[model samples]
Target chain A: MARPDQIRFRRSTLGEDVYEALKGLVLEHSLSPGDRINIDALAREFAVSPTPIREALARLEADGLVRKRPLVGYTVSPLLTRAEFDAMFEMRSLLECTSARWAAERADAAHREAVSAEAATTVAPQEDDPDGWHAAFTALDARFHDLVAEASGNGLLRDGIDRLHAHLHLHRRYFPYAQASATVEEHRRIAAAIQAADPDGAEAAMREHLARARERHLAAFD
Target chain B: MARPDQIRFRRSTLGEDVYEALKGLVLEHSLSPGDRINIDALAREFAVSPTPIREALARLEADGLVRKRPLVGYTVSPLLTRAEFDAMFEMRSLLECTSARWAAERADAAHREAVSAEAATTVAPQEDDPDGWHAAFTALDARFHDLVAEASGNGLLRDGIDRLHAHLHLHRRYFPYAQASATVEEHRRIAAAIQAADPDGAEAAMREHLARARERHLAAFD
Candidate 1:
């Protein structure tokens, strides 16, 4: 094991290091939903004192990534219900549609080209490669949405949408590979609309995509 | 001052207690935007050790309520710029509109009555009393929105919207109160639409209300 002080000193910032580490744990499902986290153990594991760990936990708690029982300590927040899943997607549709509309209004040739390139990257020949497709598509999807947010020129909207996107990742692993391909196709359509600079078309395409995604996710629950 | 051990023993869930305390500081403007907070000082002030304070700061930082400088320590996040403010309101308009739509779809007689009564409370004789109206209206606004979220039956959406609402209060205080009566009137219209269970009407009314609110807020920056 690495020396405690060595690890602590090596970290650029105690809070950030702890945050990245814990967020990884949640994403990987090493810490499943509703799992209680022991602060002392986490502190020792990270080779820091309890302070940074506590700080990291507090951040995660507020993000709804974790839940705190007044005296019992922190637990990973539970998986979203069908209703929650629908509502979240409804929100995503609204934001993403708005983003697409703005992107159409604001995207330059370079931004349009960049989004197209991202979409093309997702269409590899390996038809059954779920992992490769998932990894590639995830980055592309993020880039696509980010490009829209950036083009929208709305920092606060971008920030809020980005945060929602992050929390949505909590359930990403549960999505089947087939569903991901459909998302890739949707991205292509959205990018095309932006490239065409048709704000109404882009908004419609993005909303349709989200509606489809919501239906697929709800089906999985059933 | 409270006993150190007494405070520590009063809450072993350091992260949660710290999050609540720090959140209060941010919302109440006890820690204004860009104001630096020393962890050690916070620890002392809370009558707890550095562990909880550090933890709480981490959480606040994540929520965008506080920001950490590499070596300087944490500070309250600054106010949003005009573009950022516009984006926030645009998104708020979208979400709150959706919330109102959902409320209309699901609101019972009791819920409708509650919303009507809350709106009625804001129609005071002192139309110029921003502070008093703010105090009353803010709580009513919260309850109105909370009820909408509850009606939506999505815990995740409710949580996410509530957090955004809290952060928004940070900037709302700066908005001038010259049009307090107009604001109250807008709320009344929104309440009436919701009471009528007209989802489309409620949504349209909310959009108008938010758009007007955004204009009012933006005018302040001029």
Candidate 2:
């Protein structure tokens, strides 16, 4: 039999495990947007109590991935409207531009190395593996922005950008990975500017990249 | 005795009630930073189970107020380091300036009215009621910023600013209200610029106000 301490440790991590599981369910569309989450059913499925399930849902709610109403329990947050999309892009322009500039000015050697590594590894994802390619590109894109945010040398700034990116990931999942080649080149420009410690160049490059990304995403609606 | 539906309805709001209670404790410093939050203790204190307490802590963690650890449990997050403070101010400069510009451009009659009302209501808080004065000033300051953020016509932007402000409130509670007169004048400038729909003027005014605020806050460290 497991020791008492061992059992306690396992239980302690149960909430975190449930949080990750629910997040996966939401992102993978196992729990579609606007789908009401049956808390008791989830607890039974996961073989845990309702406490952990409720805790997990609360964290998800804060992520803007889920919604909770009085007496309504939890539901997956609905997809962003076009206006929300525009607002997100506008926010990105303000934040990412500032992040790029700070990354250029404050990035240490490790941060520069991270930027270089991301640039070197990026390539044109294959069309045959659409699902796999999408997942891979999404992760790579996230890493690139994450590295820049970290390099900004501002914890709150990094966290704000991280949360914004987390919200964007949902909308991004539905969009095509078109303009991969163009984005790779754009990344190179951003990387170059950061490496050279050219804050203005870094800011401008990020702005241009986001402007293009907005154009590409807007095409989805049309 | 309450009916079955009424019982269910009461149970539904338990988590929200617990959340507010816990938040008050943290904001009031009844639960000081680094203090361990015993789940069972809270459950017993509130005369409820641990489920709602866990949910409330999860949300607080997302707010960057409470923190969770593996094997251990929840604790109030530590005070912000100088670096963290600088990071927050930098983020505010980017976000608030953009928000002010947008408020100037996009604010309808209702938003303009909110700004005017808040500005008109301002007065130099009396010294004897420092606690009351502080609370009043904080609320008015929050309303001024919130109005600008709402007038930005971007939900995501407003939410981002709101969360950052929530985090800053912890640090700000320690600072004095010495700059109230200067701040009132600054608010006037920002409100006038927004009312006039001068985006550039509003942006510049906000940037200047934040710069001064930053200077005032930095004095706390000296």
By TM-score, the best candidate is 2
* Per-residue accuracy of model 2 over A54-124 as CA lDDT, tens digit each: 88899999889999887767888887788888888888888899999999999998898889778667755
Which candidate number would show the highest DockQ if scored against the true structure? 2
Local lDDT at A115 for model 2 = 91
Model 1 lDDT, residue B1, Cα: 62
Kindly report the TM-score of the first chain in candidate 1: 0.85
* Fraction of native contacts, model 2: 0.95
Q: Which of the numbered candidates is closest to the native, going by highest lDDT?
A: 2
Regions of candidate 1 where Cα sits further than 4 Å from its true position: A1-11, A123-136, A178-180, B1-18, B123-137, B175-178
**Interface root mean square deviation per prediction:** 3.1, 3.1
